[model samples]
Target chain A: MSTQIPKNLKYTKEHEWILIEGDTATVGITDFAQSALGDIVFCETPEVGTELAQGKTFGVVESIKSVSDLYSPVSGTVIEKNSDVEGSPEKINSNAYESWLIKVKVKNPGEISQLMTAEAYDQFCQTSA
Target chain B: MTLRTSLYQKHVDLKAKIVDFAGWDMPVQYTSVKDETLAVRKKVGVFDVSHMGEFFAEGPDAIKFIDSLVTNDIASAAMGKAIYSPLCRENGTVVDDLIVYKLAEQKLLICVNASNIQKDFEWMNAHAGKYDVRFTNKSEHYSLLALQGPESEGILKKFIPNLPSLEYYSVWESGQTIIARTGYTGEDGFEIFGSHEYIGKLWDQLIAAGVTPCGLASRDVLRLEVCYPLYGHELNDEITPLDAALAWTVKLNKTSFIGKTALTDYKPKYKLVKLLVEKAIPREGYHVVDENDGVIGVVTSGTMSVVLNQGVAFARISSDKFSKGQNYFIDIRQKKYPATLVTKPFVQGGHK
Candidate 1:
């Protein structure tokens, strides 16, 4: 199954995607990540105002069989935590990229450039699969 | 190399997510486990459970030999009857949970867990002890097609014209097939046992009839939802039957079984209880702690209940944990999630 990687988003090796818009960036797991973690039951995200370091575990997404650590693409402070996704974790299964988990106010916007582009992430998913 | 069942190609053709389960290359799901689980509960679903092992104990002393090894009474099982029990060690610990089918007065067929096929054989052989019976592992000879749900009988009745009056926990032999009205899903279902080639053909027939092929993932969830005791999780060498809440499986009056002496008046220190967590899902080996933050016991089996949409799990807690009537918490990922004590069977059984 081919995973959907949107061109507008930057992705981390941990399969989290960051949509940088000004100082605030929306975060959610990529489609590839959600598919691999089938039938996600719970998503525990870092609370708002929580500081997350680059490549650090900011949250956890639990599937039926296993649990995966959701990492931050860049160092940032959590601006908003999606209560909607928490209430309905299956939303990620329906559309991973659409159900944003959190919005982080990026401390260093320049670090977003270090993440993989949509094309690069798609190729990475292929090789990994 | 992992073993492949007769329905492996069919699962592959359906674009199933295959995974290594008990050293077998089995499909985990075709679509999603949640969807598949719902289908089985609401409508109908078929499962390829051909990996389970089958053994035959045939001789004049078949009843004596089989009864001595298992915890349940073989005398209670008449001809063409199936009985559920655990193969226990001498010390009252379970070696494996299996079902025994009385093929004849001098013959008995046993269905065991796939992973415990070899172990159960070895244990049974060692304990036979001059019972004048021959134990043969016929696991490779049979392939099981589990047609489960409210519509299970309707689906199976289509092909088999002469439907034998098979009751629950009873087997009926019609030519080369053995139709047993038994399943772990707590549903009114049949485990059709036949040759691998025959099973493959039957699988195609079921799929053509629009039956959803469920995977082991959903099977585990469905069984857990009904409070059925799974071998490795709920029962083990160390976990007694009473500890797993399977006291019904142990018949202490059974004639001189392996674990009879030790479990004569056994009272388990741990009690199996169902819990519903707030949001976070509880997993195996997670600590179940008391209100005082002391580790009381551990979660044996856990999953997110599709029907309840909440974290439901079975944990083996100490009897003393409830003496003070304090609530319990499951320590998941270094965080404590409060869990409410609920009755057995996290969901009301939808079985007919």
Candidate 2:
């Protein structure tokens, strides 16, 4: 199935995506990630004010079939979590990018250079599949 | 490496996510578990259950032979009728739970779990040698499809006109297909048994007839919603039917059976109960704890229920510790979530 991957976003090997604007990065799962996980039943995200290092576990995304760990793409402190997900986790299934889990203040702005671009991530997914 | 069923190609064509289940390459989901599960509950859904085993027993002593093997009274089951029974070891421990269909006075058909095909066949054969019965394993030769839902009867009536008349737990042969009003999912459905080659056409016909294709992931959730006991979870060699709350099928009056002696002395120590978690999804092997934070038992099978839209689980808890309306806790990861002990089925989606 074809999934939407915004060109402006950066992705991680773990399938999480970050949309960086200034010092804050909006975090959510990629379309490829949501489709792979199937229906999202529950999402356990890191609380606000929680500090996370690059490549560190930030939360968990659980579907009917399996549970996957959500990794932070960039080092940051969690500033906000999506309260909509707390009420309706299925929002992630509908539009994964729009259903951002957390907004974090980027610890190191240059660290975004290490993340893969949308095209690269799409190619990575194809190779892995 | 595990074996693949004939429908493996169909799963791939549908872009289903395939996973290794009980040493078999099976489709975990086709579209989505939520959609497929809702389809089964509302309309109709077809499933590829060919990985399950089918065995044929026929001869002069067929009835006598099967009666000795299972815990249910096969002699009372009329021709064209099917009964669910448990095959127990000498110690009253459940080896496997199977469905036995009486085809004729001298012939019977047995359906067993996919993983226990080889072992079940060997066990049945060893016991058949002492009697005038013939056992034939036809699991590979046949393919089974389950069409289930409230509207399943309507879809099936388009092909077989008299399908509605077939009573529950009864089997009828219509051409090459043996249609049985039985299914694993707690819904009114038919289990069609036919040759491997023709089964594909039947699946296509059902799809053309508007039956959604379902996979193992939805099937597991559907069964869990109805509180149906799975083989490895609710049953095992160390657990008895009495403990699993399936004593209704065990005929204690039977003079001879594999587990008769042990069953006579069996007492319930642990009982399987259904739990509805308020916040978390309790998975298999998760600890079931009491209100005092003492571990009592472990969860056997659990999933995010589609019908209830909540987490449901079946766990074997101490009989003394289990009580109605009592709140229990399930340890998911490191967090303890409150769960409640309810009736067998967490949801009543018309499986009465």
Candidate 3:
């Protein structure tokens, strides 16, 4: 079953969710992504000062079953990292959107246009399934 | 194009993730390996081990015939008792490690790995010409299930009324089913052997009684936690039972047997050691390196442990290369990560 995606957020084809509010965008994995990964055992996040390009793998999330890379949705500098997620990665499986991994300061706000809308992402997941 | 077991439909019905392992379609996991591992440790869980092979040996000289093949003393085993033994070649190399259950003086049951079933049967039958014993490969006709955990006894007692009274490493036959209080997992469990037709019903009965259905993923982690030697990992054709630290099972005091001469003259150059990596997870085929960045050995089985929450691996390293508390490096994709050699069973005594 497909999970409900927030209408205001943008999504990536790699199953990452981006919540843009002003110059800073919060990024986390989708609920569908966490369920597919099973229990989250460990997470490796990029450094706070590291700069990432859009569609580039910045970190990795390892669950009990498999390990998946987390791709950056917008090209920017990572301003904040989730310390809570580093300690207890299982929080991502419980609430993916609330447990944001990184908050990146947007370098070019126009890059958000490349992400799919909520309706588009829902249809994309359906077709892929 | 791998062989599927009889419980293939049941596994698919439970939404299990299936994978091809050693030429058999097996369930890797049903929900999560971590949760299933914890369940078996604290409560109860059941596994579908029908892919394993079972054989029956009968006749007057069954004990004599089997004693000559395996490294263990099968003649000393009383009826209703089981002993783990290794079948070796003339060159002191292990063919397969098996559990031989003595049902009576003339009847014995042997459980072997699925991949080596045919070869092991051929080896046993070839040597049966002198003895009155006859070997039969009953793998296709039997299904094996393991009910393991601390609460396994309570759950199993509901079906088999006398199950809780049976001692460890003992076998009791109930009609067509053979119930043995032994399992690969380091827990208080029982391995039930019976026909495939009745196993589905038994599985449903256990599920109805609140026993969780676990898959091979959890089974591997459970066995690893106890430092049990797997076939491809710790035991292989080139490695002798003595080299793998399984010399306790080998009875060299006995009379002539296969590999006895070579085993007496053999001196192991390398030994198996459990390596614990901090922060860095070592995987299978990963090179084990020394302080000078010289490769010494390779990792056989590795995984991110749920209990330890770190990377644990079992590797065969040069005996004189490293000692306890000596640090080494594992080349994980060109990055040399730090690791240390520790004793087997990263986790200490729970059950065996």
Model 3 agreement with the true structure over A1-129: per-residue lDDT tens digits: 568698889999999999999999999999888887888887878889999999889888887546688999999999999989977889999899898999999999999889999999999888885
Native contact fraction, candidates in order: 0.65, 0.59, 0.29
Worst 10 residues of 3 chain B by lDDT: B343-352
| DockQ for all models | 0.75, 0.76, 0.39
By the lDDT metric, which is better: model 1 or model 3? Answer: 1
Per-candidate clash tally: 0, 0, 0
Docking class of 1: medium
**What TM-score, to 2 decimals, does candidate 2 have?**
0.95
lDDT of 2 by residue, B9-77 (tens): 988988888999889999888889999999999999999999999998999999999999999999987
Give stretches of model 2 more than 4 Å off.
A108-110, B162-164, B174-176, B319-326
Model 1, position B318, has a per-residue lDDT of 84
Tens digits of per-residue lDDT, candidate 2, A78-119, equal 999998886788899998888999999999988999999999
Residues B236-335, candidate 1: write the lDDT tens digits. Answer: 8896787777887788766688888888878787898888997788989999997778999899989888878878888988876655457889999888
| Candidate 2, lDDT over the whole model | 0.88
**Candidates sorted by DockQ, best first:** 2, 1, 3
How do all models score by TM-score?
0.96, 0.95, 0.88
lDDT of 3 by residue, B16-35 (tens): 87888778899888888888
